[model samples]
Target: MCGIVAATAQRDVAPLLIAGLKALEYRGYDSAGLAVLDGGQIRRVRAKGKVREMEALYRADPFPGGTGIAHTRWATHGVPNEANAHPHVAGRVAIVHNGIIENYADLRARLQAGGRAFTSETDTEVIAALVDERLAAGLDLREAVLAVVRELEGAYAIAVIDRNAPGRVVGARRGAPLLVGLGIGENFLGSDAQALVQVTHRVIYLAEDDVVEITRESVRIHTLDGTPVERPVHESELSADAVERGEYRHYMQKEIFEQPRAVADTLEARLGPHGVLPNIFGAGGDELLAKVRGLHIVACGTSYHAGLVAKYWIEEYAHLPVGVEVASEYRYRDAVVPPDTLFVAISQSGETADTLAAMRESKRRGYLGTLAICNVPESSVVREADLRLMTRAGPEIGVASTKAFTTQLAALALLALQLAHQRGLDADRYAGLCAQLAHLPRAIEDALALEPAIVALAERFIPRQHALFLGRGVQYPVALEGALKLKEISYIHAEAYPAGELKHGPLALVDESMPVVAVAPGGPLLEKLKSNLQEVRARGGELIVFAEGEAGMDGNPARGALLRVASGGDFIAPAVFTVPLQLLAYHVAVLRGTDVDQPRNLAKSVTVE
Candidate 1:
């Protein structure tokens, strides 16, 4: 989950590299470093902690050059320390890499046998050494990089600087993400387009195994095999404001409040007089949905939770069996493959490793077709899938997802309606669901209005050690998501169980000190869920319920505590209910004084498995 930013320009490139790294800090890194070719030598600085430390070091003693590469590393091969940080230099070459090199030990041994000295405990250093060795053998910077990449294995997106080639930076990618930003008389590279948005809005995303050579006045793209290639430069639609934190204390909070607008944006063009548009998922999607015998979803983390919610929607509306699995586990197992099952892959950043692999596996095993529900349009997952539904939530900066998840649910809701419509469900019923969807943005806004009350409730949870979330029917996934948010940001131990499953094991953990959160939407299952809450209450468990409509528990002492969030419809309740939980997590983390945006041991997009 490392971040890479490199630049070759007419002016000093260190400042631009620093700004790019700052833009990518939300991806979560443990260390930062930079390398610049100055005075025919690779000058480098590394810091074990935040980018600010690296910035301070650079301000004190800057490494100024026309070309440079920088990295914010989330450690994998070695500990997070100055020695283990990136921009690993060897001889005249400095390299910053993302993703692990699978055969580094063998490469390191070969290099050591060649009498090459290593200064850092990193596979990246081995890469630099190999490249330097190739350079020593009369290969130019581009050729050296290409030669070394052929000998390496596993995912990597690397930027290399050769002191011999003063004004150029060579970058190559395989499994990890890398893109080039186009600017007048300059060129840029970043692990994410966000890192380059401030400098240039035009970008070219590199395909796997594509190598790029960048200079102050020109850029050339080629395959790893040395054949020239061309890639389209698209004008990025993301504004600088989307990635900035304005009034909110953290990006997570800003994202939480952006859900209403996100959902509104996602619903655009998908709704009309015809209920749900048949072609919202792109061409031929309606026909595929009409023919599929079953549905299977593959995703990881928050996307998986979104899939869990989609399971209920698809099964209920489309009258088709739905199965959901964690993408990591799904790819490794010998699971049953149903014929004509519609495969769906969901991710906020289409670069999630496990999810992308699972999508490939599903496609290989012969599904009806694959659909990618993702936020970014040109992501790997969307590019490979047969049909695509872009969430259009824009850029999600926070590690803990908010707008992305809500927008994903909105997209899946559209899919569910399309399936129902094609399955010959009642026309009036479909139109009614569309009407409810039209009201979702406003309902999310109303739920956001309940933030103050949710914040007050969060203060009560600050000192608690554990929390249990409960819901029945479709709200079960909502409960799971709420628990995930609490545990992820606040560092509180939390678990979720279906209300009916309480007696199986979770009920035993209930006590006076434990707070039990219930997603009580007051549908047919409300009375049953109340009975489950009574079991918790009987055990002296403190109760917090996010109720929809009047559950008769308002101001009732038996309920312990209640917060009402606007329930647009049961179809849209997941999106509405998510607002308060996100608020609760934000407030609790703030109260606990934890890092709200970048949580410990987590990255925004899991690029490496």
Candidate 2:
């Protein structure tokens, strides 16, 4: 479940639908398709690969369809092929769906028993058949969707268009994200605001269990029980330029370079003469964070790595214990949570299925309050949270997530610093930490300056099949993030372990052929990390170290790739160190001719668990 775009407008919405699909391409899809109710009938076009292919197919012989729906599919229920591509049609109805229909197998059997043949193996097709069956029973489009959805179980967002009802689209979301874009003589539906940015800025964020029916002039929403409701129309801050790749070779590279500005945007208003303002999180935010005794940070992928780094910052600065967990695992198995613990959920999209579920579960598990550190303002996690701190990284169109990661660190750093001040930590030390954080934007800028060196390092990784990353203390999470970037974009197998853990078990795999990347930011653990690097050197492992220029690599022996970055001190070191690793991954992927922005087998947002 990845992306969906639905629109009914005065003009031909085929191009609009296709553009929306292309805009969501960063979410990673193996197939794409669109269905338009053209000329009093439904016409379908599906492609087995990128949206560009489908656009090419559509444009080869364009048609005037004033109403249409489209989707970019990240395969879950079936193989990646045209047959399984979205806009699944049954009878006169066509639909595009995101999220799992958990009871699809049973539904499919039930439908098959009724002698209805299925066209696709997707759970979505079963949904289409049910809706079609309801319509066949003389139910209207809205009633048909409501009846079918009531019989279904699991998280889902669906957009259905019927050939009999032109210039209208019916959408419902129970768990996944779906929204409506409002415009004169046009209205829109999208999984994310970015999808509708090209069409309109005004959007109505559909809440859980909300069903919406949109015509060219009006939008009517109802609950699954058919109770009428009204959703707020938010003027999205996302500009068309924010989602475009300008000057940079790819969105990933653009986002990597944008980190300096991104981090600055996140930290600017929050930090003042007094320190981090409590209001930056939300209104009355201080009440939520003030009495926190501990934190239970939950996230997935890159966000999880950020949480790992935050554990160190909070414990070091605020003198508070922190527990970090993978969101998917945390919700499934929980033992105990101490009193006065703040539940923190961090995500770029703020719509991660696991993280959202974990945060919801934590509410019942007794936490002080829930805070969402997210990039998207209108995302579900932010809306459902007791407090929210926006990263202000703008729109991160890259699937690999460069600016979003750094900006999240910047936000987390602010939280840690604010908590430190609240706890009456040393005045001078707190000020120093604030200064380091303020200098983070420039530090990230300096780090991006090392791209030429990272490019040279990238050449070394071109032929390598595997790599290793090492760090100590807070940098261990940076190491983990570095490993993730290399593996995700370059498709090289990479692993990260604390430098001290080399001898424990991981060192057995190190050899002359293995490239070991060491994140050697200047800190108290530098000496210990140096010793660990020597262990790799003695074993003939190719040593690649990213260190601060002040961290004397001249005296330290372990070497291969010694790249120096601007030192932001340990307080903001994680954000600075992340830049070069991101660039290295980008260049390495470019050299290998791999997709950098839309990495294979990965989506920009994990909407499905």
Return the top candidate by lDDT: 2
RMSD list, candidates in order:
1.4, 1.4
For model 1, name the residue pairs that clash. none
Q: What is the TM-score of each candidate against the true structure?
A: 0.98, 0.98
Clashing residue pairs for model 2: none
> Candidate 1: where are CA atoms >4 Å away?
549-559
Worst 10 residues of 1 by lDDT: 550-559
Q: Weakest 10 consecutive residues, lDDT, candidate 2? A: 550-559
lDDT of each: 0.88, 0.90
Over the stretch 1-609, how does candidate 2's per-residue lDDT look in tens digits? 479999999899999999899899877579999999988899999999899999899889888888999999898999999999989999999999999999999999988899989878899999999999999999999999999999889888899999999998999998799999999999999999999998899999999989999999999999989999998889998899998898989998988888889899998878987688758878878877888999999999999999999999999989999999999999889648999999999999988999999988988998989999999888899999999999999988888878889999999999998888889999999989998989899988888888887888799899999999998999999999999999999999999999999999999999988999999988789988888988988888888888875343454354476877767787888888888889898899999999887888888788888
lDDT of 1 by residue, 373-433 (tens): 9998878899999999999898888889999999999999998888888888888888888
